[model samples]
Target chain A: MINSRDILETIRMIQDENLDIRTITMGISLLDCCCDDIDRSCQKIYDKITTKAARLVAVGNEIEKEYGVPIINKRIAVTPIAMLLASSGGDPVKYALTLERAAREVGVNFIGGYSALVQKGFAPGDEQLIRSIPEALAKTQHVCSSVNIGSTKTGINMDAVAMMGDIVKEAAELTKDDNCIGAAKLVVFCNAPEDNPFMAGAFHGPGEPECVINVGVSGPGVVRSALKKIPDGNLTDVADVIKKTAFKITRLGQLIASEASRRLDVPFGIVDLSLAPTPAVGDSVAHILEEIGLETCGAHGTTAALALLNDAVKKGGTMASSHVGGLSGAFIPVSEDAGMIDAAREGILKIEKLEAMTAVCSVGLDMIVVPGSTTSEVISAIIADEAAIGMVNSKTTAVRLIPAIGKDVGDELNFGGLLGAGPVMSINTASPAKMIARGGRIPAPLQSLKN
Target chain B: MRAVITVIGRDVVGILAEVSGKCSELNVNIAEVTQSVLQDMFCMIMLVDMDKCSIPLADFSDIMKKLGEKHGLSIHVMHGDVFDSMYHV
Candidate 1:
């Protein structure tokens, strides 16, 4: 039996608290689309993605209307273009253009997987794809790119890390006029998940099915609201409240994923148990931390609060859905979350503190904007540090930094919408040029030896 | 298929009659309804069977929403499964 209290609670969560399904990402494998000629491969890739995801947006809308829950983005993730580039052996930008066309045709908000996985070393097409990311992203509006430059098993690829530093700078420089949006669409990951449904880091890995539907659920505001009801509760009470709230949120995600999978006739993939926040008021993971008794998001003890919240979310979400994968925890994207943005502007959320938080949270250095004069080596060093955290901890971490080209530490770069406005956060300018120039791989950690 | 229709607003005269009349017009069968008045606010939750409705649930929801707007009420219609999945296992 359904009660009025439950129905009203659900309605309030949607209407006031901004509860939503962040995305319904269809992962399509482009491995079979590869051909000897670049044009033929592009054609095959376009046809496959367009056909596979043709009904994605429409079905997402139908579900949204029927369920009364907003599905924010309908996206597609394909096999990394680098693998196909190895076969086609031409300009990788062609694949980006094809993906953009397919995304526009099929009406997805973003098409991810313009990517390369060079965690150990650069393969035949890996370097080419990495070098072309700036041009590819600058040329296309709806395509997202990621490069996995390190992992626990293979360690950090310093050469790829160095190259990605230049690539991230070039991407931001190329799109400086558009609020440095190119870099916003590009992510550098360590231990990247294969079936992540979020962007700008989502991709269909080689291990995935030919076609699958993955769902990302979000409800930071709902969790925060639940905590507000327990103002004098102990820390354990806080964890229990978050666990119950996360369970409800993930159940909705599972329901929607199953419905979409059944409708699209594609296999159902995991439900990413994430608390993804937007710039909208009342929708922030940072606010959840504050609700846990922090003066601000970057205050001391913020890491402990985040660690508790992330663990509780995963614990509750694990039981709600049969399959839980991807970066299943709290996402603290500096720009996307309203509370984080305010904290950044107030100088409370420093980059170093964010790096520490990433050790406990889901992603790392996400949507952070640095000064234009900051060198590529600094960005690479930042990636190395974040990658080291993920490599050592054996968790997924990513860096999506925008070099606010022609902008300074205090200036704000507004991309609007879900990408949000990034306040240019200060970076340490001390050079790491020599370290980056060494161009050698950091050996895998002892944690990787369990196999 | 069944849906949950919730109407919330300031206490109004004949709000139930108005809503149930629309359901009858659309051939939707009302399975259950619960209403309460707290102070000056009125809240109602209705479980309606839409398997024999005259219009699609989406369209029916829009119609009910428009009707609520005319009477200054907040309205929402969602699949019952959303509630079952969230509140239940």
Candidate 2:
């Protein structure tokens, strides 16, 4: 028996509080598509993706209407292209073009997996693909790329970290006129997840199934609204509220994931328990932090609030869904999140503070726009800092810094839509050139160390 | 298949009759209906068996949406599983 209270609450969450499935990302394995010839590999890649995800968008729309819940994006994630490049041994850009075409053909908003995992060291095709990211991203419209340079068990790969600095800059420079959109699509990461359903960092890991459906859920507004109702609640009460709200949100994702999997006949993957925020007014993770007794998002107690929120979200979400993976926590992307945008523009949210928040939050240094004059070495140093956090803490952290080509601090770079806009925040200009130049692996930390 | 159709708006004449008429036209059998009038605002929840509906589920949703707009009410026809999955587990 369905109760009216639950039905009304669900409706309110969807209608007024901005509850929605962030994405239904179909993960397609391209291991079988690898070929010695580049063109043949590209052809196989395109055919496999188009065929597997042919009805993804249509099904997403049907589910959205039938369930009265909004499905924001129907996207795809594929096995890292570097493995295909390893066998094909040709222009990595060809794979990017092929992915863009497949995304267009299948009518998906984005296609992720132009990626390489050299967390410990460069593989056969890793370095080449990393170098071609700038050009590949500049040419393609819907393809997203990510590179993992470090992991907790293996430590940081300094060589790939240095190379990614140049790649990130080139990606920004190549698409300078288009709002540095290329940089927005490229992510440099430590401990990257292969099954992430989010854009700019999602890639189907080699271990994933031939084809699977992963759902990412979002609802910062719902959480905030719940918190607002209990204004006098203690810290424990805050955590409880978040847990209850997250349970409802994740259950929705689990339902959608299983249904989509049943219809598509693809194995259901994880339901990422992330509070992915949009540029919309109520849908901001930063605002949720403020609601949890903070003066502002980047204030003194910001990190502690974020930690509680992230932990409670996972605690609640884990019980709701059968399996949960991806970067399953509160995402604090500065540009894409409305509260972070306001705090950032007002200088309350500093890059250093964002770095600190990332230590406790899900992702790191995401959607931040810095001055174009910022050097590759500085970017590398930032990535190194983020990688260190992930390395020492045994968590996933990534850097997606967009260099506003001709814009200075206080200037805005607007990408429009879900990519949102950001004011060019200040960054440390001190030269880390020597540190970045001395490229060698940073050895792994002891796993059992306390305090 | 079962769906929960909820209509919320200012209290007006023939609200239930019109909604039932649309459902009957589409061969959707309503098993249970609960209506309330709170402070002059009308609220109704209808649990309908959608298996015998003539149109596809999505199309039926579209028709309900258009009908709601025409009558200036907020109408939502969502699958029962949404409420079940969320409220049960």
Candidate 3:
């Protein structure tokens, strides 16, 4: 028998605490859509995505209304475009335009997979796609792009890393008039997941099934509220609370994923157990860290708190869902998170401290706005450092930095919406150019021999 | 399919009658109902069978929400699976 207390608790979590499904991403494999001619491939890609995700938004709405749970974004991730580019030897921008059009027509928020995987080395179409990312991102509105420059097994590709710095700079410069929005849509990844449901890093890996429905579950607000109730609890008790809260959140995600898959006649994919924060007050991963006995987020003990939170979330969420994948942990996007924005604006959250936090957090240096004068070499060096951590630890890490063109540390760039405003955080002016100039792969670390 | 309809507001006469009357008009069968008053504020939970309802789930929810607005109460109709998946293993 269901009790009133349990029902009321669930209702409060959804109504007051912002518990929500962050996205219902349909991953469609475009491998079979490849053709010799570029236009033909574009047409095939458009048709496949449109047909596979035709009812995605409708199904999401139905589930949302029925369950009284908000489904935030209905998105689609396709097989990385580099594989398609290898067969259709032509301009890759055509693929981006087609994806943008399809996204608009199907009424999805974002269409990802304008991407390339050159983590180990540049394949036939890898370099070409990476080079064209700036143009592709600048021209499209709803399309997201990503590039994998490093992985744990294969190690970091320094050549691609070096190119990405310039690519990010060019993207920001091209869209400078629009708050450098182009760079906001690009992600440079280390050990990028094959089935991430979040953007701007989600791309359906080549190994993914033909069509699948993946759900990303989020509730930083719920976790924070739980923590607030046990203010004097010990560390173990805190972890227990987080675990229980995450379990409930992931159960909802599992329910929605199954419902969406059954309705769309697609295979059910993994549920990403992520505490994704938003610009809304009381909805922040950083706030959760603060609730865990920190004066503020980015304080000295932030990394350790984040490490505990991430592990407990996985422990609880793993049991709730049949399969848990994607970057399943706490996301600390600077701009999109209200607590992070406050911490950054007050100079409490430095870039280096955030970099250390990323070693334990789910993603790395995400949505950080650096000074426009900061060099591309600096950006590349940041990526290399982050990739090294992920490679050595065998965890996923990514970098999504936006250099605010013609702006300095004190100024702010407001992109509005989910890509919330970011206060330009200062960077170390000391050049890492000498190290970044050494453009060669960082060989994979020894996995068997633990030091 | 069954749904849980929750209504919370100031205690008043005919609150239950108005809600049940709307359900009867839509051919919805009420499986169970529980109501209580705390400090003159009313709270009610009604489990209704939606399988034979005359209208779609979305339409029915909107209609009930509008009815709640007319009566100055907060009403939410949601599928029972949400509570089951969340509260139970």
Q: DockQ winner among the candidates?
A: 2
Residue lDDT tens for model 2, A330-350: 999999999999999999999
Q: Which parts of model 3 have CA positions greater than 4 angstroms off?
A: A448-451
Candidate 2, residue A350: the lDDT equals 95
Q: Ten residues in a row with the worst lDDT in model 2 chain A?
A: A442-451
- Clashes counted in candidate 1 amount to 0
- State the fraction of real interface contacts model 2 keeps: 0.84
Candidate 1: RMSD to truth: 0.9
**Chain A TM-scores of all predicted models:** 0.99, 0.99, 0.99
Quote the lDDT for A424 in model 3.
Answer: 95
Q: How well is candidate 2 docked (DockQ)?
A: 0.88
Best by lDDT: 1
lDDT of 3 by residue, A1-451 (tens): 6677777788788888999999999999999989989999999988988898999999999888888789999999999999999989899999999999999989999999999999889888889999999999999999999999998888899999999999999999999999999999999999999999999999999889999999999999999999999999999999999999999999999999999999899999999999999999889999999999998888999899999999999988999999999999999899999999999999999999998989987888899999998899999999999999899989899999999999998999999998999999999888988888899999988961455
The CA lDDT at A250 in model 1 is 99
Best by TM-score: 1
- Of candidate 2 chain B, the 10-residue stretch with the lowest lDDT total is B6-15
Kindly report which residue stretches of model 2 are placed more than 4 angstroms away from their true locations once superposed: A448-451
